[model samples]
Target: MNPSTFTVMEGEDNERIDQRLARDMDVSRTAIQQWITSGDVQVNGKEIKSNYKCRTGDIIEVVPPPEASPLTAQPEAIPLDIRYEDDDVLVVNKERGMVVHPAAGHASGTLVNALLHHTDALSDVNGALRPGIVHRLDKDTSGLIVVAKTNDAHEHLAKQLQTRSLTRLYIALVHGNVSHDEGTIEAPIGRDQQQRQKMAVTNVNAKEAVTHFSVLERFSEHTLVRCRLETGRTHQIRVHMTYIGHSLVADPKYGRSRSSPLAGQALHAETLAFIHPRQQEKRTLTASLPADMQALLDNLRSG
Candidate 1:
């Protein structure tokens, strides 16, 4: 097994080794705890427990566990709004409420389940549970997503994502009027320690994340903004906007309680652009605002 090494920085002193490593590695704490239990994590070349306190000069080594067997995802008869499709890849306009892939409580009715039924083959780089899924959108945020049909295509798209060459643009209605016409949020993002279910702008074991946004329109109590992602961390846009005191309209997790016609956040993945893996050409796909988001905008305008 290949091992990764890190030095505990002065700022990380007294932090639990597992927690520090998980934050620095951008992985789950649970995964790091398992590694500690299995003797896969060492401090100064000695196996350490999960709660081992770190010193400023400590050297840590981590050997990741082997991949588990792939989960079998069953096909479901879920309808899809396919925007573009080719032998190499498929671009889909996912609805706001649809989960991208299955997980604990969401075992079916996901985009993966729909794709399985619609296509005979999908790139297995992400395993069976998320076959062909190159990226993801939150369940309450609707937008365009690309799926790979083959391993080569998956590798190409994934590489584009890593290089920040793929363009991901989103449209959101935020809860407050944005004063700046355009701005960028550059912050480190990590899972919230207090609220484990949420992502937060944190420096602890966090990754660099950037979101660029411009105001599209202004309302009395809200602003419509266009956000372009330079890094695609989970909930990057949402967290960044909230950090600036402009959470999305109707956002349950980050926004203040208010009355709204919408059931979820007013966020949408409106555009996706990437170099085609097979055709060797640039491809850009867009999805219009879904009915619910559009309706919210109309309501705001009419008031």
Candidate 2:
């Protein structure tokens, strides 16, 4: 394991070493605490506990094992709901609550882990952690995601995303009756300055995010809408919809508190279209709403 070093910034004043390590290293604080216990973590060349408060100019060092890296995904026996598969590409209807790749607080049972179990032919362009992952959906957002089997395919698919040729659509059940039948939301999305864990629509270091939405159905209080993303920014659909006063129902992060049977924010990746890597053919894929969302809609319709 190669040692990595970082100096505490002024903005990190009085932050816990483990918290800083998690942010800097992108590994969970649990893993960081283990490193602290093993004496693999040091501050200013002296050993310190995970809860040690960091001050400006404090140099921290970490030596972590490769297996403990958030980037290394191991194969698991989890089953995958594959929608389409070819030699060069594979499209899977990722289930809700499954992390797309290994990350902080999510080391296993990820889609990447299942993919590794299914095949060893995943493209390495995104490195060991992501492997063949071309795109991702939020953990609670169930939907279609494409994977590349070869580096050539990964590049081809990525170009489509960069050029805005790749199409992604989502079903969003949002709060309040949407006043308009259809509209476009063009906003810049960036990390929430106050809460680092959440995203917000802001011009400060933000990126162009455009979502075109149309009402699919309207209930007494909520509106079910279809969202088309022109630019894939982090939390684009959620943030944009919330920016327009229609945050998805049950969204723990950006939504108003409400009671619902759905396990997560009522959002689903319903469609994905792109040019095939090998065949150079345009392909579109779709998935039905999961049981929870469908059931919720059914109940709403009945009521």
Question: In candidate 2, what are the lDDT values of residues 244-272, reduced to their tens digit?
Answer: 99999989888998677877889999999
Candidate 2 matches the true fold with a TM-score of: 0.79
Score candidate 1 by lDDT.
0.86
Residues 106-206 of candidate 1 have per-residue lDDT tens digits of 66789999999999879977655678988889898998999999999999999999999999999999987899999999998876879856889997657
Clashes of 2: 0
Candidate of highest lDDT:
2
lDDT of 2: 0.87
TM-score of each: 0.79, 0.79
Per-candidate local distance difference test: 0.86, 0.87
